[model samples]
Target: MLQDVKSYLGRCFAIKDLGDAAYIFGIKIYRDRSRWLIGLCQSVYNEKILKRYHMENFKRGSIPMQDKLRLSKSQSASTPDELKRMQNVPYASAVGSIMYVVRCTRPDVALAQNITSQFQHNLGDIKRELRVSCYSNAGYLTDADDLKSQTGYVFVLNGGAVDRKSDKKSIFATSSAEAEYIVAFDASNEAV
Candidate 1:
């Protein structure tokens, strides 16, 4: 396949044989031909993020975002000192680091990452099992400020989550059932 592609594309691409990438960007790639499996991890990337944010030695938490912690645009910097402190907080960078993990190996933290991302412009502070089935869920009017519902879904394969998403519904849901229906639709869309 490589030779055919090389022949078709001529020599402009400058493709080199890297011998089965050990890491791409920050993700560690693993392959087990015996089991017909491939795996990706971001432990090194995670460590860098923790160290960057000075959380390397911090205690672990059961939940990525503590329950009932609501972040809103209202949290945007108000006073001059607050703005200065926010500038030094590296909130966007931290969210971006977590986002890379979310895009790579940790779907369990999708909700937390999504929420953190919403607050990235302002400021704010900030897993996996293998399974094949997906679980879908929704919360009605969960966004305290917007009255929009939220949807969360995870697709697990081989005892680990391979795909996941958590986002606010584009439209407001009048009832919990409608919110659930919207989430189910979103999940099915992802499955397809």
Candidate 2:
């Protein structure tokens, strides 16, 4: 069937069969015919980014960021000397690089990515399984600058993350419960 499709396409269009795709847009592809599983990885891209930022020598951590960590504009370069020093740091560039990874195959880091993204001016894992499951969470008043709540959720299908999001709520939540409700609502919307 695959060959027939390829032949038909070849007859109609100027196309060449590249055999199996090993990499697309820098994401490595792995195939397990016995298990009928295809996996994607970006470790090489990740390493290049780390080396670009001189972070290849840094220690690895289980989680991207510390729990309860709050970042705001207040933490940005405040003094003239601090601003001058920050001028050399590619804060926005670094964040943009990692964000591509988050969008592709790193839903676990979504929350951390979202938090750090709020300060682009300042700048900053997974399992496989079968059943589909979703998780929703929110941080009440987590944004120190705006006092806005943070919402996050991930959808896992067949042991892999299919969709995820992390962003600050547009409106302020007066209570943690409210924040939770907001996240739940957002997740429900995404699920549908």
Candidate 3:
């Protein structure tokens, strides 16, 4: 289905040129000058969320969540839905900010956000785990920009992400093994 709403908005505004969409403040824009192909992105908005959050220099880990991060009592999983659960240990803002980033650019980040958002109300264990240091299941996807765009996935079994991404898979995979091999191939290509 047509997941993106901007195209709907475009029809509403009846915008002729899709060129000026790059610098809408909350969005990121990448344009192929030679090809005159413009790409609109929300990365800037993600960065802005970080700035507004002010967690830019704290500590950037490879994954969004920690290892073996649980939802036991007296932890971030407690409370029906309260913010007092998160006491110290910085980065909730960053976590939330990244949620927005993932919402904009990455769909694989869904699992991470689901696990982290639980702590939105209760983050005690989250803060403690990160401090000492320490992790759900979910999938999230935002409005895709282009037609048949390949979504990026960063597989994370535990809190730490085993993989990170730059681009989406190029070819369509017919099976799970093919998908893994494709990602591996993509990584190898990027490594070169």
Candidate 4:
């Protein structure tokens, strides 16, 4: 059927068959006809980013971000020397690079991506299972700068993550329970 359509289109327009795609826009593609499965990966792109950032020798961590990690504006460069030092770091560029990976094949890092993006002007370090299930959580008043809660959720499908979000709530929650409720609402909305 694919060949027939290709031939039909070919008759009307100039076209070339490059055969099965192994890579597109830097994401590598893999297929298993016997199992009828297809997969996309960006290991090469990821490695290049690591190399570009001089993190090729850094130790790997089990999680994208440290547990209970909190970032605030106070952590930003304060003094003239600190500001000068931060100017040399490609903070925004690094975050943009990792965000590309997150959007493409790493939903597991969505939370980290969201968190890091909040501090684009401050400069900072850059940093999945499938089950057709979702998990949501909130950190009450986690944003020290605004006293807003942080909400996050991830949806998994077939042992891989399919959707995710991590961001500060637009409204402040009165309690942890309220924060959780908000996150749940957001997750449910996404599920629908």
Candidate 5:
């Protein structure tokens, strides 16, 4: 199949001589033959970022972001002096590097990554909500803005979220039921 693909592409795409794709785009791939398992990681990439930021010896936090933290545009640099200082901070690059790790291996960090990247120029509050029942389990709004509600869902297959979304609902949902419906519809669409 690979040979056929190589022939079809007609040499424009050069297949690297890397021996079974152990690494691709900063992700390290691993395979277990007897267990029939394949795993992906970005530990090396993560370490590189940490080193780049001079945090190689920093203590690890138990949680990436604390729950119930609020971020707003007001927090952005409004003055020219502040903007100049921000330019030297490498905030965007750090967030982007973090995003790549989130995309490749750390699904748990999706919400945090979303909030950070959205406000790359400007962003945090966290809320913890657990589902108690189908009807009663509508948890706290992950988004604090009154204009829109955020909805996130992950479709887990073989222990990974193969298709996942963390985004705002297209329209404002008036009630918890309406929000639930929108989430259901989004999840089902991805399932199909």
Candidate 6:
């Protein structure tokens, strides 16, 4: 019967019996006899990560990075020199979230998470100071302290920075023209 076949296959593949298929491989499963669809979303994974990392009680953020969020380098971080130690950061929670979704073909966050993991330790030391014209020239001129969220966002098109950032810029601009001038120069140099 179909039940026997399902059991055999499930055992062969090492699947847990959830009774009803609610999810699989990070995808939320829904079925209809006449219609079919499968979607990969962050909902369940988000909750799992929150709970595992003890952030489950945090007010669910509407945006990934808050406008007022800030992380400064003043706090001394424990930078492990060994690669093995790097894997054991108390906060590997950020990396775990990326892996589950990445293998499922969600490519949007690939660059962001990769960059985050690289700076796993000594994240504080990497911060740059404010009010420097050089930062503006390089297209990073916001408060560096506020840019420490575990995600990255880039909005570019045709190989240009429509909006791109690894972290926040280090300084606020006094005027639009000054900001644009700096951005233009940076992009031109990058293209070359």
Which residue pairs collide in model 1, if any?
129-159, 129-160, 130-158, 130-159, 130-160, 131-156, 131-157, 131-159, 131-160, 132-156
Per-residue CA lDDT of model 5 for 67-133, tens digit only, reads 4667778777888887777777777788898988887798888898887777876422223432211
TM-score of each: 0.46, 0.57, 0.41, 0.58, 0.47, 0.37
How does each model score on lDDT?
0.78, 0.81, 0.53, 0.84, 0.68, 0.52
User: In what order do the candidates fall by TM-score, top score first?
Assistant: 4, 2, 5, 1, 3, 6
Q: Mind giving the per-residue lDDT tens digits that candidate 6 earns over 1-192?
A: 978988899888977666876766667766565667555565777688778778888644212322233454444355545435445545456776766776675676565566556655645344422221122333333445653222223444333334444433344555555556556555455433
Regions more than 4 Å wrong, model 1: 1-21, 31-38, 61-69, 75-77, 124-192
Per-residue alpha-carbon lDDT of candidate 3 for residues 11-74, written as tens digits (9 for 90 to 100): 7887555544546547667889899887657755755665676655665445455556566546
Would you list the rank order by lDDT, best first? Answer: 4, 2, 1, 5, 3, 6
Clash count for each candidate, listed in order shown: 10, 2, 8, 2, 7, 5
RMSD of each: 15.7, 16.5, 13.6, 15.6, 15.6, 15.6
Off by over 4 Å in 6: 1-21, 31-37, 61-89, 125-192
What shift in Å separates residue 25 of candidate 2 from its native position after superposition? Answer: 1.6
- Model 5 CA lDDT for position 178: 77
After superposition of all CA atoms, the RMSD between model 1 and the true structure is: 15.7
Write the residue-wise lDDT of candidate 4 on 94-154 in tens digits. 9999999999999988998898888989663322231257899999989889999989999
Q: Measured by TM-score, how close is model 3 to the native structure?
A: 0.41
Total clashing pairs in model 1: 10
Between prediction 1 and prediction 3, which has the larger TM-score? 1
Candidate 6 — worst ten consecutive residues by lDDT sum?
A: 128-137
Q: Which tens-of-lDDT digit does each residue in 109-180 have in candidate 2?
A: 888777777876743101222455789999999989999998999987645577789998899898999999
Backbone clashes in model 3, listed as residue pairs: 28-41, 66-134, 66-159, 67-134, 69-135, 82-121, 85-123, 129-133
> Candidate 4, overall lDDT?
0.84
